[model samples]
Target: MQDYDETTAFLGQWGRFQQVVFFVLVASNIPNGSGVFSVVFIADIPRHHCLLPDVNITEDWLHVIIPVEVIDGEEKRSSCSRYRLDVVRNLSAQGFLPGRDVNLTELQQEGCVDGWSYSKDIYQSTIVSEFDLVCSEQWKQTFTSTVFFLGVLVGSLISGQLSDRFGRKPVFFATLVVQTVFAFVQIFSSSWAVFCVLLFVVGLGQISNYVSSFVLGSEILTGHVRVLYSSMGVCLGFAVGYMTLPLLAFYFRDWKSLLLAVSLPGLVYLPLWWVIPESPRWLLTQGRVEEAESIVRKAAKWNKVQAPQVIFKDYSAHVDEKKTPSIERHSVFSLLRTKTLRSLTLILCLVWFTLSTGYYALSLNTSRLHANPYLSCFISAAIEVPAYITSWLALRYIPRRVSTICVLLTGGVSLFFIQLVPQSIPSLSVALEMLGKFGITSGTSLMYAYTAELYPTVIRNTATGACCMVSRVGSCIAPFLLELSTFSKFLPYIILGTMSAVSAAAALFLPESFGRPYPQTIEEMCQGRRLKFPCLPPKQRSKLSSRELFESKL
Candidate 1:
C-alpha cells in the first residue's frame, strides 16, 4: 500500500488546505481550555464568617460576636465559629468590650447554625459561596474539580479509540456538542450534586475533542507544519482561551454567567464540523482509498495544485497477509502487545502523568498566588503564550529529547525553590510562580508533538488517549495537591516540583523523533525498534481490502 503522506503529497505540505484545517482545529480547542480552568473562578472561596439569625447583635459588634484566632500566623475572625449569640448579646447589654472588658476566650462557641455570610468583594457568587462549601464541606470544592478531571479520565479512554474506530471529524464534533450542551445545562443546575453531575459530562467533552484535534492535525499536516500544529498552535489556542477566563470571571462574578460566556464560544465551532474534513490518512488506514482520494483531490484543488490520476497504489491487489503482521485488531491492548511498545507505553504514562499533573496543578494554583487572583490567573495564562512559542521554536530547532529534559527540569527546579523565597518579597514569589508555570507550560506543550511522534499512526490516537487517561489521574490529583497549601503553604509546590523532576529523569528513556517520519503501522514504531518491517519503508495492508472495498459494501 502507498505510504499515507506519500499518497497525499499532491496536497502540498503547509498549503492553504492544511493551513485552514490547522487553524480551525486549533480554534476549536479554545473552549476546551477555558472549560477545564473555569473551576478556578467557579469554585472561588471568598472571605466568610458565621451568621446569627434572631437577635440583632449590631454591625458594630460583629467583631465581638465572632471570636478571633491566630491562623497562619495572622489574627483573623473565625470563618466557621462564632461566640454564642446569647452570651454575646448579654455582653453587649452590659456595655462590655470583647477582650478589654471581658475575657473572650471563656466565651462559648457554636458552628454557623443559621448559615454563613460570604463576602461578595471577590465574587458575587460561586459554587463555594452559593452551596456553602466551606469548613466541613470545604473538601467538596476540590472534589468538584476532581470529578471534572475524572470525567476527562473516562473520556480520554474512549475518545482516542472512538476517533480511531470512527472518523476523527465525527468524533471531534460529537464530543464538542457534548461539551457545549452540558455546559449550558450546568448553568441552571439548582444544587451542587446536580452541578457536579453536569460538570462530569462537560469534562468528558472538554478533553475528547482536544485529543481528536491533536490526532487529526498530526495526520493532515506533514513535516514542520505537523510540528507547529501539534506544539504551539494547539497549545497557544488553549492559552488564549485560558487568558480570557480571568477576564470573564472578572466581569461576571457569578459562576453561572461565566459558564454561559465560555460555553457560547463552542457554538461558533459547530460550523467547523463542516469546514474541516475527516483525516485522509485515517481514511486510508480503514481501506477506504476512494474516499481518501476524493478528499485529497479537493484539498489539492483548494491548494491550487493538480490532482494525480491515481492517488494510491492498488494495495488490495498487492497486499499479502502472510508477509505482514496482522494489525487489524490493534486495540488499546496493542500498546502492550510487545515488550518494546509496552515499555514505551509505560514510561510515556509516567512522563505524561507527572508533567500534566504539574501543569494543571500549577494552573489550578493560580488563585493561591499572592497578587489579585484575576491578575495572577491572567499572568499565568499569558505566560503560556510565550512559553508555547518558545516550545515551538525548541521543537523546530532543538532536539525533542533535549528540549523535554530541559523544560521539565527547569520547571521542577523553579517550583521546588519557591519555598526559599521570603514572604517579604511577594514579587519574587510571583516571579518564581510564573517561572514554574513557564517551564511546565513549555515542557507539557512539547510533549504533544514528542509523544505523538513516538507512537505509530494505526494506534496514534489510542496511544495518545491511553497516555492521557493515566495523565488525567494526575489532573484529578492536582486540585487536592493545590489544597495542600492549607497545611504547609509550600507542600503542593514541593510535590509538584518533585514529580516534574521525576518525569524529566523518566523522559531520558524515550526515543527522539525530531526528524523522523510518522510511523505507519505498529511494526514500524520507533526507528531503532522496527519489528518485522524493513527500516526504509514497509508495505501497508488491509485484510478486507483484497476481498472487497469497505466503502462499496457500506
Candidate 2:
C-alpha cells in the first residue's frame, strides 16, 4: 500500500459520511430520556377521589373509583375514572388485597391516589374498607428506573474501552442489535423482575450509542470541525430525546408501548454495518497498515478522488520497534506517571464530572421549575445551539488555551450567580439558567477537543475513557445530590461551578497542540518534536521547520 499526505482529502470524506452516521447514532440515545416516564406517571393524575355517578354497588365486593380529569373543565369526554375494583381483582388473583397488605402511604407513593396530598378521610373510610392487597410489590417500578441508570454507567465504561481496543463499528453494530432486542422484550415482560432485568440490558446496550458515536466522530474529523460536529450532534440528540420523552409518556401510558416506540428506531442502525467503515486511524495504531490503506482508498473514492500512490505511513510500526520485547502494555495507573498527562487527565475528569452532574440534576429538576416542564426543557436545550456554534467559532479562531479557560470560567461564574439570584424573580432565574446552560455546554464541548489534542494517539482513547468513567461516577451521584433539601437548592450547582473553575486552572499546565500534527507515541509527544525530511540521510540529523520535522517523524 502507498502512503499519501491526504489529511485534507480524508477530512472531506469524513465530513460527508458523518451526517448519515450521526442520524443513526443519535436515534440510539432516545432511551436515555426514560425518566420522562417516571415523571409523567406521577404528575399526570391528581390525588383526590370523587364519587362515581350512576354506579351500582354489590354486597360481595366494594368499589372505590377516582375520577381524573384528562382535559380540564371538560367532564363529559375527557374525564375518566380509575377503578380500584380492577386493581383489587388483579391483586386478588396474586394473593394480595387492599387494606390488609397495602397502606395509603404505599398507594400514594405509587401514584395510585388522585390528589397532590393524601386525603385522610377517604384513606380511613374507603381504602380501609376495600379488599386487602400487598402494595410493597409496586415499589418495583421505582427500582426498575434506578436499575436502568446503573446499567448505563457500567455499559458506558465497558463500551468505551472495548471500542478503543477492538473498533467502533463492531461495538456499534453489536450494541444496536442488543438494544433492539431488549427494548422489545420489555413490552412482554410478565413480572417486575423481568421488566427490570430487560430495562437494565436495554440501558447497557444503549450506552454504546454515545460512546461509539463520539469516538468515531473524533477519529474522522480534525480540529474545530471535530469539536463542533461531535458535541452538537450529541446535544441535538439529547434535545430531541428530551422533547419526545414527555410526548411518548403521554401517548403510551403503558410501559410496553413506550419501550417499543423508543427501541424500534435502533433497528435502523443495523444496516450501518454495510455503510460505516472501521476507523482508519485505529487500524494504523494496531499496525494493520494494509487494512488502513484500503480504508483510506475507499474514503478517497467516496470523496471522488484518486488514491495517492504513497499515502501516510504507519508510524506505529516504528514505535513498536523501539519498545523492549518484555515490556507490557501500560495500565491506567501508568497514565499518572507523566506529570503533565496526569494533570490533564485529572482536570478533564473533574470538568466532565462537574458538568454532567450539574447538567443532569438541573434537567431532572426541571419539573420543579414554575413554568411548563416541556417548554422549560425546550428553552434550556435551545440555548445550547448557540453554545455549540460559539464553541466552533472560538476553537477555529481563538487560542486553544484561551478558549478552554474562558468557557470553563464563564460557566463557573454563571453557576455561582444562579445560586445568589432569588427564585422569586422567575424571569431572572430563567435568564440566568439559560446563561449557565450556555456556559456549561460550551465548556463541555470544548473539553472534548482539548482533551483529544493533549494526548498522544497511543493512549488517547484509554485516557479519554478513563476521564469519562470519572464523569459517570458523578452522574451516578447526581440523583442523590439533587434530592437534597430545597433550602440548599444551590448546593449542587455551587459544587459544579467550583469544580469547573478548578479544571480551568489545571488546564494552564498543559501544552497546546493547535496547528500541529497529532503525536503517534509517548516518546514523540514528550520530546515536543516534529518530523523533518532528510537533507542528508535517515540516520543524519539537521535543523528544520517544526512542521517539517513533525511530518518526517510521522
Candidate 3:
C-alpha cells in the first residue's frame, strides 16, 4: 500500500484543515507549557530569614539576630537560624547594643522557633513560603518536583501504548482534562501533602497529553509540515505557555493564584474536541480503514480537493515487508527484538535521558539565576522562541546528526564556561545559562522530530513513550542536581555541562533522519537507517547478509 502521505495526497498539505489542526493543537499546548514549569515560580524560594519576635528594639538591630553565613559563596543572613534570642535579649537589656559591646561570633545560633519571615520582594507567597519547605525541609521542595515527575514517569509508561492501543485524539483530550483539572485543584490544596498528591495526579496527565498531542500532530500532518509541527510549531507553542508563566507569576506574585490562573486557559480547549481529527496514519496502522478514510474525506473537503473513491487498499505484506515486521500491534518489548533495534533503543534512551536532564536542569535553574526571578524565567522561556525557530531551520537545512551534535555541544560548552565567569558579573553567567538553554532547547525541539521519524507508525508512540519513561529518571533527578550547589556553587553547572557534552557523542550514532518520511512499519524503519560503521564481516560464501544478521539468527 502507498504511504499515508501518498494515500491522502489530495488532502493538500498546509491546507486549511492542516492549518487548523496545527494552530489549535499548538494553542492547546500553551496551558500545558504553563502547567509543566509552574513549579519554578509556584515553589520559588524567596529571600527569607527567620521571623523575629516583637521586642522593644529598633528594626536596624534585627540583622544582628540572624547570624551571617556564607551561602553559595555569598555572606548573607541565615534563613534557617537566628542567634539565640535569649542571648540577644540579655545583651540588649544589659545596654550592650548590637555591633557595639556584644560579640556575635560568641553567640550560638538556634533554628527558627517563631517561623520564617519571607521577603515579599519577589513572591508574596510561594509554596516554599506557605509550606515552610526551607532549610531542613528543603528536601520536601525537591521531592515535590520528583513526585510530579514520578507521575510524569507513569504517564510516559502508559500514554504511548494507550495512544497506540486506543487512539491519539481520545487520549489527548482525556489526559489534557486530567492535567488541567488536577493542576487547578492543586491550587486549593490546604497542605503541602495534599498539594504534592494532587501534583502527582496532575503529572499523570501532564506528559500523557503532551506525548499524545505530539504524536497526534506528527501523524496527522504530512511532509515538511510534519517536520515543522514536530519541532518549531509544537515547541514554540510550549514556549508561549512557558513564557506566560513568568508573566502570570509577575502579576499574581502568589503560587496558588498563578497556578490557578494558568489552568483556566486549559478550559478553553474543551470545545476543541471536534476541531482536531484523529490521526489517519494511526488509524491505518490499526486497520480502521473506513474511519481513517472518513477523516481524510473531511480533510479533503476542507482543502477543496478530491480524494480517491477508494482511499485505502489491502496490503498482503510483501515477502520483505512480512519478514521485517512482527505483530501488527507491538508492545515495548518489540524494541529489544533485533540487535539494530536494541542498539537504537539504547542510544535513543541515553539521548532522551541526557536531553531531558539538561533541558529541565537549565529550566528549573532559572529561579536560581542571580537576577529577578520573573525576568530570568521570562528570558529563559523567550530564548526557546529563537532556539526552536533556528532548530527548525537547521533541521530543515542541516543534516540531522550535525544539528544534534552542534546544539548539545553548544549547550554543554556554554555550561562549562559558566563556572569560569566571574561572579561579579552575574549577567554574564545568566547570559551563558540562557545560551545553554538555547542550545538544549533547540536540541530538545530537534529530538522530538528526529525520534518520531526514526520509528514506524505501529511502534512510534510506544518507542517515544518508552524513551520518555526512561527520560523521567533524568528529569526526576534534575531538581536535586541543583542541590549540588550546596557542595559547590559551580558543581551543578559542571555536571550539567559534562552530561550535555558527553551525550553529544550519542548523536553520532543516530541515523541522520532529516527530510526523511515517518517510517510506517518495522521494515520501513530498518530500510531508512544505515549503520554508521560497516563493521560486519565481508559476506560469507554462504551469503550471510547484514539485515539478516540484524533481524534473525544466522
Ranking by lDDT: 3, 1, 2
Misplaced by over 4 Å in model 2 are: 1-146, 189-196, 310-331, 529-554
Judge candidate 1 against the unseen true structure and give its global Cα lDDT, from 0 to 1.
Answer: 0.82
Candidate 1 stretches greater than 4 Å from native: 58-60, 94-97, 316-327, 526-554
Model 2 Cα displacement at 345 (Å)? Answer: 1.5
lDDT by residue (1-554, candidate 3, tens digit) is 45667767778789999999999988888887898899998887888899987976545456578888886568898889988888777777777877777777888889999999999887889999999999899889889989999999989979989999999999999998999898889978999999999999898898999999999998899888888889889888889999988888889988888988988788899899989899887766654557877898898899989887777644322222443343345789888876677888898888788889988888998877746888878888899999999998987889988998999999999999999998689889889989998998898888888888888887889998999999998999999998888788889889888888778987788887776677776655665676543222234324533333222210
Q: How many residue pairs clash in each candidate?
A: 0, 26, 0
Question: Could you give candidate 1's per-residue lDDT for residues 190-239 as a string of tens digits?
Answer: 99999999999999998898999888988888888888988899988888
Error of 2 at 113 (Å): 12
